[model samples]
Target chain A: MQDAPPSLLAVDGLTYAYGARLAVDHIAFDVRRGEVFGLLGPNGAGKTTAIACLSGLQRPAGGTLTFDGAPFDPVERPADRARLGLVPQSLAVYDDLTALENLVFFAEMLGVEDPREAAVAGLALAGLQERSRERVRTFSGGMKRRLNLAAGLVHRPELTLLDEPTVGVDPQSRHHIFEALETLKAKGHSMLYTSHSMDEVERLCDRVAIMDTGRLLDTGTPAELAERAGLPGADLEATFLELTGHRLRDEA
Target chain B: MKPRGLLSAAMCIARKDLREFSRDGVGLLLAFLLPLVLVAVFGFIMGRVGGGGAPMPRVDLALLDLDRTEQSAALVTALLASDTLDVVRPGPDSAPWDEADVRERISSGEDPYGMVIPQGYAEGADLILLRDPGRDLEEQLVLMSLVGALFDAGGEDFAWEMSKRGLEASGLPPELTGRIEAVVNGFRFAVEAMFDEAQANGSFDEDAAFGGGDGADDDGADGDGENAGNAGDAAGGNAVGMAEILQLTLPLELVDVAPEGRDAQLGYQVTHAVSGMTVMMLLFSLVGFGRSLLIERDKGTLVRLLSAPVPKSSILLGKLLATFFTGLLLVFVLFGFAHVVFDIDMVSRFDTLLVLTLVNCLACTAFAAAIAGWARTEKQADGVSVLLILTMSALGGSWMPSMMMPEAAQAVGRFTLTYWSLRGYQGTFWYGQHWTDPEMLQSMGVVLAIAVVLLALASRLFRTRYVRT
Candidate 1:
């Protein structure tokens, strides 16, 4: 019998807590190569926590994460991180440095041998080649968001994790970021994309997982979840509301 | 870990930090321009204070001439010609021969010496000199002695003129007058010789000659005269043995005399202060840079870096190196300003000063890192850093000379980097002591040791506790 193809990233029975309160509770997920997986949730849902845990930022209280069949220890195993990249919600790129410098710095951090070439390629892919030498401080919020996404891809990691990468950006930059993500998908790069925008989930995600209160509420293609929730021919937003209920989850 | 790879990562972090800092205009200004401004201001103030140059003492005098004779006026004019005494005319109601008023003025401690030429003073009466004992004793004594010598010579001239007139009246020849003067001097010499032998042999208990002190112990009797001679010798040693020249000019020298000992040259003092303040302010740069760690961590940049292949240790080391280099750069800028503007000598004992500055920079970086480790926000780090820097400046004698402070305070100041740095700098330019001098070497050792301990503590704290999970 031949061994099964390795999952690009796997998180099993993951659980994490903030103080006495549980933030990520036993959430299970896996991303295969060439798959664009969407983690859909409203604000304060366990989306960021799950991503943090999967990216090895937080140690799961009770779970195991493996990348390409290798056990992941975020603190000790720096080699595991070479295969992963994170584009945080906030623009983590240095504002005082130029766009190219920012990309090169991140590339260097990820152990890229030819950071300049990697930076140029990443900038070209993000359509920021012309603005590569401009300081990020001068860039618009949307432009900065696009540059942040490009910075994450400079080292060309196999698994990229984007946590709310498109929030608060202009529609133009948001479009650019989505187009870039789709292009990456076409190029067969796997990604774990988390966002609250159901339309984005519907458009970009090959498979969508709905999470609320640290638990996976549902997991399937948008159409399948919509059908399972009995919302015939409805968009993901209506189907999500039907499955998770209408009450606000503002109170902890 | 591969050495080359680690070096590459460290270099990358350093390059990134340098780029960011270079582009940060406000940071550059704070790190460099502010210290230059402070040095300029301090230098101006120090120059105005006439620091370590000399003391300028002023004196006033009042002279009373009762005898309106030409001779008496000439004698008064001679006293007025001296620069040490600023001669002033007496008030209208003042009697020219009023001994009471002269004594009052001298006793008031304003005029150091007062001279009263009594009635018939030029006609061979003794002049009375009043001196203020409370004034500088050397000035008072010198002025009194000068007046005594001048008047005694005047008396001798007056006596010769009177004898010439008497001889003319008696129809005696000049040859006969000279023979009679020789006979009188011989008789006087014989009496003085007898007195001198008696005084030397302690056979005479003449209280008047010895000022009431017994001459029984000749050695003890000679001690006061020896001390006076020694003081005269010291004063004479500074210049050729021209006592008259010293008396005429020493008063002027006293007006702006530098404090004895401590090598308090104005240039050295100003440079020392500027260097100290530079070190102090550069510590803030470290705090400022270290606050970036807190800000980045809070903003999730630290998390992002950690999420990459960068180890946490590398991240911390990168920050430490950045802070250290920034501090050193700040020192270079300050030293440059000191060299150009204040004319601070840099090359003499350069190794020692360099070692001192580097150690201080390390300590400052470590201190900043420790503060960053404990602080959770930029505001807290800034507030605490300013407070610490100010306290250190105060304790380190940056504000004032530690020697001028109370002994206990000075002792406490020894523990501060500013004190040791100032001492090390003074050792270089002021005392001209070499870096290998035991005292300077010891101070350097203490400062470097402190830097090591602080760095270790800061590194441990940063590594073990500062990172939030």
Candidate 2:
């Protein structure tokens, strides 16, 4: 059998908090090289907080984040920061700027060698080259979503932390985004994708980590997770429900 | 990162901000246009109401000509010409009203004071004044107006008699008083002799000799020193001869010694309006730029920026640079408007003006950053900025001259940046002082110091609000 791919990033006992309340509680996971690792969780499951810590937006209260076989603290090391990219859940583009302008600006900010060329390439990657000059305010939600994806990739970082990137996308735009991600995966890019869509997670992620209330419940491929939950024919969703229960998590 | 890289990032961000701001056409127009309109309106109103252009309120006085003589009619015309009185004549030219009519008006409170020319007034009969007892201020005003009219009517004789009476009231030793009286008589004789010679020559233009007519200077005594000196030169020997004659009549001599060449007309009201409105309005503009920080955070652009490889200081420095340049533009725009509309002398002092304005803008930019850093939301920033800015403007003499405020308030005004900034500006523009002057340097130094403290505070607060978790 082929040896498992070597790890590109590892999180050991990662923890974070907002004042007295813990937002990310001692969760650990790893993304191997050329792997699309999925972090599946419901609302308030600490997925976004973990992503924030990784992106250097929040300082970890206690934990170790190792990247490329070395100690990683993006907050202390801007070089490490430049290696990682964040696609925030919010539509973070300047509405007044055109698609190309937003890409170029973010690209330059990320220390890309040639921001203009990268921006053009990013626009094409998101299938938005035809509308690159149009202001984001004039774009549809799907188009904006696509552009937001392209913005995070403009710098071509090794690891991209996408926090619910397809939350409110139309199916057509969603399909295009899936196709783009597939292409990136083929190019040996690693992504830490957090999503609520079961089908997309199953189809895209190489290995999935089921999390709830800041704790990781399980980590395995879809079939292995079903077998471990003792429901051999059940899908990943059934395993998630079985492990995390049917209770609603609506508050953070 | 290198200093150049940091500055480059800041410039890039400022360019982006300015480009976005440019697209807001209505905001751009209102930013420059509203202050100009306000400056024009405030300048005009203050000029009129602050004793620059308009006369004080006139008191109404009723008149009844009982004597109906040439002298009484002349007194009536003089009273009508007095700026202090609104003369109300009782009857038409065909028939005049009696003293009873004048008394009735004063008693009924229809007019505060009334003048009645007694039956024998042309032959030195005294004029009777009818007045209401309660209106003391109005009564005094009317009496002063009457005295002025009487002086104009009597001319040289009235002045001579008044001076003699004043001398008698002084109760000086009889010998000294008599000797002084003789000197005055000689002066009167000398004046009559000069007049007689001028009349003989037919060269004495009555209006020109008395400094009357439209060609007379506004402040006939002393206006522009250069113009006055020129007039003294043109008058030459006649003016010298008149001065010697005038000196002989005086118990205490008066000297017309003023600075040789000083610009007394500094356009003070225009200066106050321009400086006050510029400082106040620029605060509002810079604070609005500060509010853009909250806006960017709300719009999530700040998050994207923070997540990038740019240093956090560069982000803040970029915002500061943007606000600084924008504020500088606003200051020049308002002053430029004043220059065009009010004909204020901005060109001569442009260098000092630019330095003072640059420092002022830096202070304002720091203030903007502080406000943005302190407030959590756009609405909160708006409310806080208005309250603080207006308070500063009022306390710092942006609404009026600090000298006009209560002594305690003026002392308090010294603590505000607006006060120092306006003092620097007023010194440069209104008082014609150079930037190297102690007071000007002090203002610049204090403003720079305030900018430093505020920038430090802002940097801390921004780190807490935007950078740290």
Candidate 3:
């Protein structure tokens, strides 16, 4: 077998908690360079918390996260931070501004040398070049979703953390967003995507990690997870059901 | 973080915020238009005409004529003809109201001011001008009108009485002094009638009342202040001349005095209202600006911004800078409005005003940050800010000067930033003192200190809410 690509992101003993409640447990994983890593969990399963910690939003209570071989504090290292981008679940965009303007503003904040050129390139990546000059308030849900994804990639970050980018998107818009993310993956952009949908993980993620109650349950390829669950002829969803059980999540 | 990067991030955030504000037309209206109207209305209603035009403010005086004598009539007509007093009288056929009823009308807010002419055949001379105790300017103005009327009504009688007292002290025979008094009374009555005529015709002269009136051809009673020898002719024993009578009648000359370099010019009437309004509107604007934090929180913009590589402190700094600049804009707009609408002299003390303006802006931004950090929701922040602004304005002498308020209230006012801001402006505008003057500097220092402490507390609270918590 060919030697595997070097690990671009390594999480060792990562743990985080709110006061009196643990949101993330000591869990470790390695994401190879240019691979899409899916973190699958149910509601209140610490998937979002892991993403938050990994994106440097929340300080991990007990963890060592090393990106590109050495650990760095995002607060103290703006250059390192500029290399990471987060696309949040919420539509984090200024409604009053045009798509191009919002992209330029965020791009400039990330220390991009030529923000205008990056904004235009970002719009093209999201397939929203024709509507770049329109205000976001006047855009449809899917269009805004596309713009939201574009905003995270404005600076062309090396590692992108996507927290439920398709949470509220329509079927057609979801397909468009997935295609755009796939295009980035083709260009050697490593992404840590958190989701509850097994179909999305199986179709898009190169490797998968299942976590619940702040602890990691398993980590393998979709076929490997299926085989490990003893469901030989099953797809990723059936294998996931067998491993996690059919109980209601927190939202249920 | 590099300074240039921090600055670039701040500018980006500020530019985004400004774009958001410009899109909100209604909020813009409240920020700029509302203050202009408020300042104009309050200034026009409460101020006098002495802002580079008329001599005095208008007083609303109601006349309750118990003494229907010509003396009272002359006083009433004179006051009505002049622009100083707006004389109000009952209908011609209306029944005479009691003194208690007149007092009730004024005390119960039915009338602004009332004057009672007691029926004592002009002997009592007790002219009571009824006024509300809440207003100092009104009381002082009525007293001044009374003095002016007194000069016209009983000038000669006062002079004759003074001459008679002098004759008695000089040891003149009782009979001879009595004869002098009789002759003085005849001439005094004639002078009073002449005054009445002069006032009715609207040609009332100040010099005429001091024994040098229109008919001042009585030997030594001319305008040059010479003795006419009228008292000597009447009193064969000891003469009390018209000049002596005038000297006794008007012992003290009321003269207007100003400082050596600074002229004591009459300040614009709306000055108090403008200064107080500036502070009040700034509070409103600052609170509104601070609420943007709550808005971004609700909208998830803050969280996303924090997630970026930019330092969190830079975000706060950008917002503070934006708020300070907006406040400066408001001050320029308000002062411009005051200068154009009410003829307020803003340029005379531009340096002092600018310092006070900056202090107010800093204080406002500090308080805004504090409130945003402590408040959980936009609604909570807005409600609390409104209550605090109104309370500060009331206690800090926005409606009236703190000197006119009760001692307890004045003491309470000293704790507020509003109080210090008002005092700083008043020192420069009303008292003609420079910003470096002792009292002015002290007030500005207090405001600056308050701003610094508030900023420190706000920073702590902000960190707790955004970072630690």
Candidate 4:
């Protein structure tokens, strides 16, 4: 980890607003290659907003974003999309199409030469090869999450963004998604994982960032963050609760 | 902009959309099957009303008999003899012919004709004829002539009986009565001769005016002489010629006849209606497609796709192209269905039809995209698109011909996409009408212009919404 190269995706002083409201307020973060970086926050704490900006869905009002040493401009951005992927909060895979077909479609959009082979490989990697021919609507929550991840990976993207990929999912599906993320990490794929589950952040993320009210409260390894909050023996969840407060965020 | 990359991306989106569309059986059935079912149901109903075999004009009449005499009965019988009139009696026992009922039926488009008979019609010296100015003139004439003939016959018999009684009361000599009869007969002969000469001269003048040259007059005179000579040779030929002329001239005198070479007029009307209806419905699919963009944005699929190497223009272009192709396919399917089921002529002026269809489809697709671009959610897009489409279809002459609409309403129709689409379609099937005809060309141009503007607006709006600043 110490010998790893610097962050491949970096956001500096990023700010975004929706009309009169600032969604993400001067946030800053970096995600290193081959590392699982988690953004942990309550709903509407700007986790999704920050990820949206990074994923080129929204432009920052004030800040700079770079992907792999290049400034990111969505309009001018070339088909570097082939190197990046996202597993949306909802099972973005079309419910009516077979898992294989969804993967193939995304793969083709990413300009993969052999979409079928890529789809098969992705399904195998996500441990969804058995259900490749089944429509997504028939799949369980866990299977859908796994297939969603497979669809993202069909293009063999270098970086994958997971936006609450386990929300409302069954325990088994949550476990499967974590395992799949681990596999992707093993293959040296960088990831930006956002979720509200402290335990998930502790278990899966190599580095964690806690945020509230569109501002990053802290960033470090789970244990390091705990120590910084002056709780020597406390877990990451306890540290997060103490720093961000236990009150639920009333997101609009 | 790698063309291959853009093509591949567009194909991907298209393939996905089509697959999803096909897999949602209920949705597909609603989009395609439901409209066709509605058309079939309405078509059958219209067929029944227009007559099961062919469409024919219908006239409604109300009869009143104050005299309760044989003459009145004969007049009513004659009125019933006409195939054009559907005579209805007016009374408590009969069907009510209230103004409310008449107006309601006419507004609801049940029938275009109505008539009223005054209470003292039989006793009056002149029959009070009430006519719907909106109805065909020929229909009215047929009804009037039947009643007139009955009254004339009765008046003649009454005059003859009066004269006989007067002579008997005076005890006049048979010779004096016979002389009076001869004078009346001579007057009748002169009047009849005069009427015949006037009719022949009227026909000759009409021929001369229309013929427009000395050459035509020579031909007409020669033909007339030959015809008269031939008439002398064959008794049946003369009778047939007279009968044919009466049959042709009688209808012409009553109705403003459509011009010759207009055999495809009905086909043109049907095509216009079908095309307008198709454009209106295709909006549904457009809304569905546009909503997918919102869904993607909310679910992060758009971000996922954008983060990949795909160019923004390629992504947008792909979506637009997919929509355009789908719209084109929909139009083709509708035309094909109409042709096969109704025997509507679709292949006439193939190039013009194709061009018109393509242009109209582009406009529809562009408008749909614009709607999608403005909407923040799928539901908003769906609702707005449906409302807009329904309003446009109604105002654009889908249910009735624009010519039948009030002048102000016809002007309003020009603002709707359906109007332009209908105009283009009508030009395609109707003969002697070129695409370059000012009205058709103007409509097509407007549609194309709208497509261009809408497409530009859609692209701009989409970029503004989705692209990173």
The models' CA-based lDDT, in order, is 0.72, 0.81, 0.76, 0.68
Report the lDDT tens digits of candidate 4 across residue range B170-215: 9878888878767766776787687679888874444432112121
- Rank candidates, TM-score, best first: 3, 2, 4, 1
Q: Mind giving the per-residue lDDT tens digits that candidate 1 earns over B1-469?
A: 1112455666677778778888988867767788778877765565433333322222566678788798788777766654345666665796453778777877776577777877898677867766676666446434643453354346445445556557757977888877876776677678779979998999987653411332122232232222111222222111112343344435522121222232333444565567566766777667888776787777667777778776666777778788889888887777777767666666655676677677777777888888888776788888888887887777787766676689888888888866776677666655656678898888678777777887787777776654444
Question: Model 3 over residues B1-469: C-alpha lDDT tens digits?
Answer: 2223677678778887887777778988889998888887777754643332324566777778788887777666655654456777777798767788778878887667888887763764667778877756676556655555655565546446557879989999999998988898888778889879989998997664443432222443334333333332222111223334455457632222323333223333467777778788887888788777777777776767777777777777777777788888988899889877766668877887888788878988888888887888988898898888899999998767787799999999899988988888767666666777899889989989989998888788767776542
Where does the lowest 10-residue lDDT sum fall in candidate 3 chain B?
B232-241
Candidate that beats the other on DockQ, 1 or 2, i.e. the better one: 1
Taking all chains together, the TM-score of candidate 2 against the true structure is: 0.80
Models ranked on lDDT: 2, 3, 1, 4
Q: Which prediction has more favorable DockQ, 2 or 3?
A: 3
- List chain B TM-scores, each candidate: 0.57, 0.69, 0.72, 0.66
Task: Rank all candidate structures by their DockQ, best first, as comma-separated numbers.
Answer: 4, 3, 1, 2
**lDDT: worst 10-residue window of model 4 chain B:** B210-219
Candidate 3: clashing pairs of residues: B208-B213, B220-B227, B220-B228
Q: What is the C-alpha RMSD of each candidate to the true structure, in Å?
A: 12.3, 6.8, 8.6, 8.8
TM-score of 3: 0.81
Candidate 1 segments whose C-alpha is farther than 4 A from its true place: A1-6, A230-233, B1-5, B47-268, B464-466
Model 1, position B284, has a per-residue lDDT of 67
- Per-residue C-alpha lDDT of model 2 across residues B273-382, encoded as one tens digit per residue: 78888888888898888777788888878877777776767788888988999999988888888778766667878999999999999999999999999999888899
**What fraction of the true Cα-Cα contacts (under 8 Å, chains A to B) does candidate 3 also have?**
0.48
B210 Cα displacement, candidate 1 (Å): 25
